[model samples]
Every structure is written in structure tokens, then in C-alpha cells.
Target: MQPIDKILRNYQSMIVSGAIILFCVIALIFAVIPSVQKIQEMFVQVSDIAAEAEGLQKKLNVLNALDEQTLRFQLASVLTAVPGDRSFPSLFETVEGVAARTGVVVQQMGLSGGTTLATPSAAKLSAADRKLGARTVPFSVTVNGSISAVQEFITLAPNVRRLLRIRTFAIAFPPDERPLTVSIEMDAFYEPLPTSLGTAKTILPELTAADNEIIERLGNMELITQSAEALPEPFIGQIKPNPFVP
Candidate 1:
């Protein structure tokens, strides 16, 4: 009947529809947006977990390719050659065995200094150089035999239970009927113990082709597997007096 009342009646349905739309927009902003964000975060977490699982699978594949025996042997070689302890007596024992195998008499032996760090020369570096963060203990040894025996000893040096670097090597020939004398300045290197390395750690890498070659050579070398029964009795001998002492 009145103009204002007629307008209100005509627009009431439209106003109700607008109010419903507004409520839906508010719900989209507050509730729907947060639910969408949570879904996105869950997808991201699943992707990260998948990537980590893939990485672990790759590592397992690499490990699975190697047999238990070969792995054990490789580990043994690493431990025996690059032990964590000072193990000076073991070095002496090893050299003694080598000399005996080469048919050389140990004329003199000298031990000095604990392990010390040094930058390795590029020419002398090998595959293990990068893998092992080790230190060297310096020593010298003198033996006497024929030239052939000396050559054999040098050739077999790699088979020692500890890795050796020959710093100085010399030979002398006596005037009379006697064996040739050989002198070797050597260093025995050992890996630092884990407790002493502070934050550092060693992770043995997957063996490369070059590494496999070295391992094969080590396996073929007679001295690599030389039995203690084959070695001569431990010789009670003396080390040359330290020149620095006097």
C-alpha cells in the first residue's frame, strides 16, 4: 500500500541472496584457504620423504652389489693398514717378517717420533690419500742381502700390514765377499682414532675402478696373505741410537 513498504518487500529476497554470497566469501577466506594450505604442506612433506627414500635406496643398491666376504676383506685391509692406535711394535713386527721373506738379515732398525701431519706431495699421492685423514710415524731400517732380495723387499713393501712411504732408500756394496747392504728411511701412516678426530668422520666410499684394481693387486700379492707361521721367530735386536739424542 505505501511506497517504502513496497520497496522493502520487493528487495527482501535479493538482500537475502547477497547475504548468503557474503557468508560464502568469508568462509572461503578463513576456512577453505587454511584447509588448502594444509593440503599443500602435506604434499610437500610427502615429496621430501620420497626424495629421502630414493637416496637411501641408491645407497643400498651400491652396498648390495658387493659380497660380504669381499667387503670384510677390504675392511680388514683398511683396519690392519690404517689402524687408529700408535702400534709401533706392530710395525716392527711387520718389517721383520718382510725382511725374513726377502731373505735379508735385519742389520739395524730405528723408531722415532709419534704421528705428525704433513701435506702430501702431489706426485706421491694415491687414491687412499684423499680418503684417509691419517698421520705418519717415521722410522728407518737397514738390512743386508743380495741385490735381488733387496728388489724383492721393495716390491713387496705394499703388502705390509701398515702402509709405508719410503723417504730415503740407499744401497752399498762391500769390497769383500759379503751381502749388499740396504738402508730404508720409511714412514708408517695410521688413521686417527674417531674419538680424537673431534668433528671429523670417515665414510668409506664406494670402491672405484682404480680402487678395485688396487684391491685385486693386493689379493694377488703373496705377502698380502702371508701367514705368521711362515714368518721367522721374532728377532731380539736393537734399534740404532737416535742421532738427535746425542
Candidate 2:
């Protein structure tokens, strides 16, 4: 053997140890480190999925506990009280019903602040009203009746199913013997329904005791107007061979 062979023989053990250490370092950089990072990423994904699943399970439990019929009734009562739109017809019906019940005649009626044909958009609402998530439609009614009848009308107007706020009123006493002419200015409230639903991870809101009490009160209130459209009749007969055929 030559001098180089002699040197290789002298440091063979040290060279082998260094080669092993270098191999381990390369593995750490190329494989083991990457594998550890991948494992961490998977753990994060699993955690997110678990949280989402828990949220979904909670939502499902709440939904399963709810009574559909009771919910529908409550919703109906609420919508009747504060309609999803202007509902001019229902408002008129409510006012007219109160007038008729109180032995009063509606001499004149006119809508103000918004068009009677279309629902007012949120952009048209004032900042305070928009913040409250409710819009008001102002209208004035002129009714002729006895003093007692007019007082009853005013008293019952706010308590009706269609919620109204009596902004102002004026009573006119004619020189001749005539019924009292009362001009009442009122505001009917409405809130538009949400156009979009929340994400799956969003939690459902729970109704509190106060909400239930309000719904109960609304349910007890008289509903003077009928639904604008009737519910579609349920299918009674057997299914046709071609189910797609109407």
C-alpha cells in the first residue's frame, strides 16, 4: 500500500463516523423535517374539522329539539305584528277593522313618507331606523265618530295585531251637532327578512323567555286581516306514473 492507503487505514473509523453523521443531517433536512411539518399541518386540519363538526352537532341538536308547528305559529304572529313588507292592504284592513269595531267611519286615508305600491328599501331609511333594523310607513286617517268611539279607536289602534304608533292626533269640534272628526297620524313598522343565510359554522340563536312572552301577546291580539295568498293544497291522490308530469 502507498502513503494514501496508510492514511485511510489510520482514520477509517473517524471517516465512517463523520459519513454517518452527514447522512443523518441530510435525512433531517430532506425527509424527517418535512415529514414533521406535514404531520403538524394534518393536526391543524384535524383540529379545524373537529371544531366545525362540534358546531354542526350543536346546531343539529337544537334543530331536533325545536317544534315546527309552534315555530310557525310564533313566526306568523311576529310577522303579522311587524310585517316583512309595507303590507298596505293589511295596514288598511287593520285600521278599518278598528274603526268599524268602534262605530267610526273612515272619512279619508292617505299614505306618506313612502309609496304605497312598493316596499321601501333600506337606503331610504334613516340611519337610526336602519340601525334598529326597522322602517316606518307614516299614514294619516280621518275618522268621524262619537267622542267615546274615537277614544276607543285610538286606544285599540296600537294594541292591534298590525302594530301602529300614534304619532299625533287632532280632534275637530264643529259648531253644528256633528260627530267628532279626528285626524290621526300613525307609523306602521316593518322589517325586511334577511336575504341570505349564515355559514354552516354560524350558531343558531336561541329564543329567550321575553321573546316567548312577546309572541304569546301577539298571538292573543286580534288578526283582522287574512293572508294575502292561501297555502297550496296538499296532494291527496296517488302519485302518477310519470312523477315529473305536473
In terms of TM-score, the best-performing candidate is: 2
lDDT, model 2, position 23 = 100
Predictions in order: lDDT: 0.68, 0.82
Candidate 2 C-alpha lDDT tens digits along 10-98: 99999999999999999999999999999999999999999899999999999999997887767767888888778788899889888
Model 1 segments more than 4 A misplaced: 1-10, 58-66, 84-86, 116-133, 145-151, 159-162, 170-181, 192-205, 224-246
Q: Candidate 2 lDDT (Cα, whole model)? A: 0.82
Question: Candidate 2 has which clashing residue pairs, if any?
Answer: none
> In candidate 1, where is summed lDDT lowest over 10 consecutive residues?
227-236
- lDDT of predicted model 1: 0.68
Clashing pairs in 1: none
Compose the digit string of candidate 1's lDDT tens values, residues 78-136: 55665554456667877888888888899999975443334233124334444444456
TM-score of each: 0.64, 0.81
